[model samples]
Target: MNSSLSIRSFAEYVEQFTSLLIDYSPKLISALIILFVGLYAIRIINRLVRKIMIKRELDPTLSKFLADSLLWALRLLLFVSFISKLGIETSSFVAILGAAGLAIGLSLQGSLSNFAGGMLIILFKPFRVGDTIEAQGVIGTVLEIQIFVTKLITGNNQTIFVPNGILSNGVIINYSMQGNRRADLVFSLSYDTNIKTAKDIVMQVMQNHPKVLKNPAPTVAVKSLTDSAIILAINPWAKNADFGAMASDVLENCKEAFDAAGIVTQPYVRESSKA
Candidate 1:
């Protein structure tokens, strides 16, 4: 009798297990199907988003970031839905996820700030990639604008990564924004030098330069009289790309002209009266 009773109990346990499986098998299958379909949908959506960003001419870094973020968010929601369909309560799960997200966000305050700044930069567009800019005491051409940082290639070819937070908040001087830029140059001359003669020489040099713009007209004037010298200010306008070349040419040509005219630059003096 004892052996018969043990066999009967084992049979009863197997029946119950079979019943449970029968009840859950369909739900499990449905969850699997949802998971696969959801992942495929997320991928399609990500691709579509990337195409749209490209169409809008959005920054490549920002476009990829936004697309990936959307994909992950959609996948997470699909997972929660799948769990719910499997007869699981998702409110508690969502709450736990929310708590975790909050903790992570709090811990990454600086990163979050930079992300926000990057968003602002994309939206407002104070500067764009390939533009020359000065910010945070560094001047360089923008290489890329990422979610948290911006890459710059300096004139010396050094790569610098500046945090977006600082870049967004700091003053940015975009040298490439305007099509043209003015080169401000000063040449010191002896007080006894003929101001008219020096001005004529500088103006002639600037006007004859191919890179200098002729529309606004170059200006050569006495900027200030100092104890040591008379400061002749030469302002010339040129295309943004030609600014450096134009300035260098102006300086070199001005020096040669002064030498040809037998002009002598005054020595440094601290206490002499202005001419």
Candidate 2:
């Protein structure tokens, strides 16, 4: 009788275990199916988003960032849903996630601002890669536009990382947007020198420059008359890319022409009152 009682008790335990499995198996299977299907759907959605961005000619950095962000966000939602299907309390989970997100956001406020600024820049395109821009007192060509910072290669070959937050808020001068730029130069000559003759020589030098634009015509005129010297303003237009070289050439050529023509330049005197 003792052995029979023990065997019956063991059989009852097995029956109860089988009943429990039968009761929960469908739910477990459904949850797993949903998880797999959600993952596949998220991948498809991410791929579609990437294709759309490509079609729109979006920046590659922005496109990849957006795709990954969307993918993870969708996967997180799917995870929450899958947990709920498994009879777990997703409200508490969502609350925990929200609190965590809030904490992270608070801790990274500056970074978030830069991220937002980057988004704005990518959307509006204030300046693009390879464009020469001046911002935050640094002048350089834009090397890359990232989510947090913009990389610039300065004329001195220094690579500078400027925060996008400042870039978006600050004044950005894009020199590459304009097809041409004006080269303004000031030349001083002694008051005793013939102003008309100096102006003619400077104008001739500019006109002969190969890079100088001829349609707008170069201007050489007396800008101001000082006690020590008369200042001549030389204004010439050149292609944006050629502005620097053209200015240097003009300066060198003008100096040589002035020397050849025996034009006397005024010696720079710090104390003009005493002179």
RMSD of 1: 4.4
lDDT of each: 0.90, 0.89
lDDT of 2 at 231: 89
Residues 1-275 of candidate 1 have per-residue lDDT tens digits of 99999999999999999999999999999999999999998889888889999999987766877887898889889999899989998999889989999999999999999998888888888998889999999999999988899999998999999999988998999999987899889988987789999999998998889999997788999889887889988999999888999999999999999999988754436576899
Show model 2 residue runs off by greater than 4 Å: 1-48, 58-69, 78-88, 266-275
Q: Please write out the lDDT profile of model 2 over residues 146-189, one tens digit for every residue.
A: 88899999999999999989889999999988778888898888
Q: Root-mean-square deviation of each candidate, in angstroms?
A: 4.4, 5.2
- TM-score of model 1 relative to the true fold? 0.82
Pairs in steric clash, model 2: none
TM-score per candidate: 0.82, 0.76
Quality of model 1 by C-alpha lDDT: 0.90
- For model 2, the run of ten residues with the poorest summed lDDT: 266-275
